[model samples]
Target: MNRLVTVAEMTLRELVRRRGVLLLLLLMPLTFWLIRRDSHVGQSVRALLLGISWAVSTAALFATSAARELEPRLRLAGYRPHHLYLGRMLGLWALGLAVSVPFFLLTVFDANNLRYAGIAVAMLCCVAVAAPLGMLIGALLPREMEGTLLLLTVVAVQMLLDPTSSAAKLMPFWSSREIASWAVDHTDDGYLSRGVLHAAVVTALMLVTVAGLFGVRLRRRRHLRHAPLV
Candidate 1:
């Protein structure tokens, strides 16, 4: 609908206008990739994936938080809750894809013998998981400070966890690591399958959560009934 597109376009414009934040978002993954460039090829790629995940999620959180007051007004002005959430989500996805492209090219140029398709898939999975996760966090925690601290804690645990542990799969970016393994090491089809499955499950759950919360938060009031005018 035109309403959805308008909200999405407005969200995109706001995100673009934050030039400094956009630069920092793009820089984080590049810096991470460089940090492990000398350590090991796989390390750098995995770090880059994680960086991308963190950057996208953080951006989503900020976007959702920044729009908290604006959304209710939009809902009052003929916009539905789903329209607001989905539009914002689409904008965030576009932003995430924009950020991921350069890093994907870097992997193509800097790394050797990588399954390029797998690398792209892993980055997609990272962005897919991160956007909803951030929106859900923003919905649940209204305060940006709290949402950010929680995201930092989650990212820290994700990086520190043993990949072989069952617990690792619970982390939002686990798919990034698994698919990165397949890309860099030419692992079996199992890695790709597991990564894809994990991403689907997490993305579905987060989207549902965001939808439910937004529906309730922006629902029309029961007590303040509007009667038809003569």
Candidate 2:
């Protein structure tokens, strides 16, 4: 437990130190929110949620990429795979929440007649799903640029695709859109239920995938087997 907490703390500190990255991440969502502010409240809120997910996931991707070299060393120092990934994930989730709070408050003050609770839930879902998704991408793609391009492609699809289409359901941030519909459009309870379920399932799958990847990649190999004493 202490080890996990230590890794998480280190992750938080490391990310916080990247002042430029933090500023950009914070700006992305605010930009999204501002773009649609005058057009439609629901669109603005939905875009805001997507921006939050993108920002957090991007952070997670960069964090995981940055730690790729250090993680093996940490493993040598007795850190388990779960400790490494889960701890970093916890930190990213915390960061994601911090990024969401300002936007949440923005909605509160700028948009009237919203189900604020649903917006909060959507933000939680975004943070929960995004962290592992980013880590998974970071693990698979050795180059940060490649992983970033893929992440951008996914987010672009999520934004441009029709939410009602079957293909849109596969997108990681779909739950946020669904719940945003419930919150903004005053849709039925079914939307909320589906959104929550989708978020839970996606988060579980991504975490498992990331764990497997990290385990294989970080496993210590017998590259130099010791011989019997001469």
Candidate 3:
């Protein structure tokens, strides 16, 4: 537990130190919100949620990529795979929440007649789905450029695809769009329930996949020899 917390803290510190990246992270969603603001309330809100998901996922991708070499050393130092991945995920989730707060406030002040609770839930779903999705991509593709391209492709497809289509339902951030509909359109309770269920299932699957990938990657490698820890 202590080790997990330590990793989480270290992850947070590392991200926070990247001032330029943090600025870009904040700006991306704000730009997304501003782009759709005057068009329609639903579009604006949904865009904001997507932006948050994209930002968190991109951050997770880069974070995982940055830690690739260091993680092996940490494993050699007795850190388990769960400690690394889970701790980093916790930190990313915390960062996602922080990024969402300002935008959530923007919605509250700028938009009217919204089911604000539903918006909050939708953002939670975004953060929940994004962290592990990004990590999984980063794990599978060692190159940052490749992982980023894949992330962009996923987000782009999520945006262009029709929400009512069956294929759209397969997209990871679809839950955010569904709950955004509930929040902004006042559609129905069904939307909220479905969104929550989808987010829960996706998060579970992605976390399990990430755990397996990290476990394999972090296992003691035969090529290097080092003194056993005392």
Candidate 4:
């Protein structure tokens, strides 16, 4: 238990040190505020939260502490790779929620819109889901430069594909535009039932997928250790 806490704290501190997390959690929000300064407060706030989620997800992927260090050092330290992976995910999720609270408060109280409150909640869930997904990618790829490229490629593909298109709606973190449109077309009661459920299911699936990949990596590492060298 103490080890898990230590790992989580270490992961958060490492993320903070990278500076990318700051840019994502701070600068991106500031950028949205600057560009949309004259826009309707509610709309601007919603856009701000969306932008924050995107940046946070990308930054989390690129700033993973585990990926930055050599696997040999990690194995040598007697750390359980799965625990370390889970701890990193836990830390990153906390960071995502930390950045999200301001956005939620802004939408709920300052923006004077309960709908945006729902949207904000949904976006926070997206960030929570995205953290492990990002970490899984980071673990598999491990190189920051390559991981960044891969993250960009995946985001680009998701944007182009529009998982919420008429055919499919199960993609992890379906974009804000899709959610907003659903909210507009259907009443809050109807949208909540469909949209929130979809989001929750997708989020759960993402976490599971990430855990599975981490398991696979750990198994491969153990297998390599037992194999005879040529």
Q: Per-residue alpha-carbon lDDT of model 2 for 145-176, expressed as tens digits? A: 99999999999999999999999999999999
lDDT of each: 0.93, 0.94, 0.94, 0.63
Cα RMSD (angstroms) for every candidate in the order listed: 0.9, 2.0, 2.0, 4.4
Q: Each model's TM-score, in the order given?
A: 0.98, 0.96, 0.96, 0.75
Query: What TM-score does candidate 1 get on C-alpha atoms?
Result: 0.98
Q: Could you give candidate 4's per-residue lDDT for residues 96-164 as a string of tens digits?
A: 877777766655554443466456656665677678767766766767778778766655555456444
lDDT of 1 by residue, 16-124 (tens): 9999989999999999999999987999999999999999999999999999999999998999999999999888888899899999999999989999999999999
Model 2 TM: 0.96
Clashing pairs in 2: none
Q: How big is the RMSD of model 4?
A: 4.4
The better candidate by TM-score, 1 or 2, is 1
Task: Please tell me which model should have the higher TM-score, number 2 or number 4.
Answer: 2
lDDT of 4 at 155: 56
lDDT of 4: 0.63
Distance (Å) between predicted and true CA of 177, model 3?
0.4
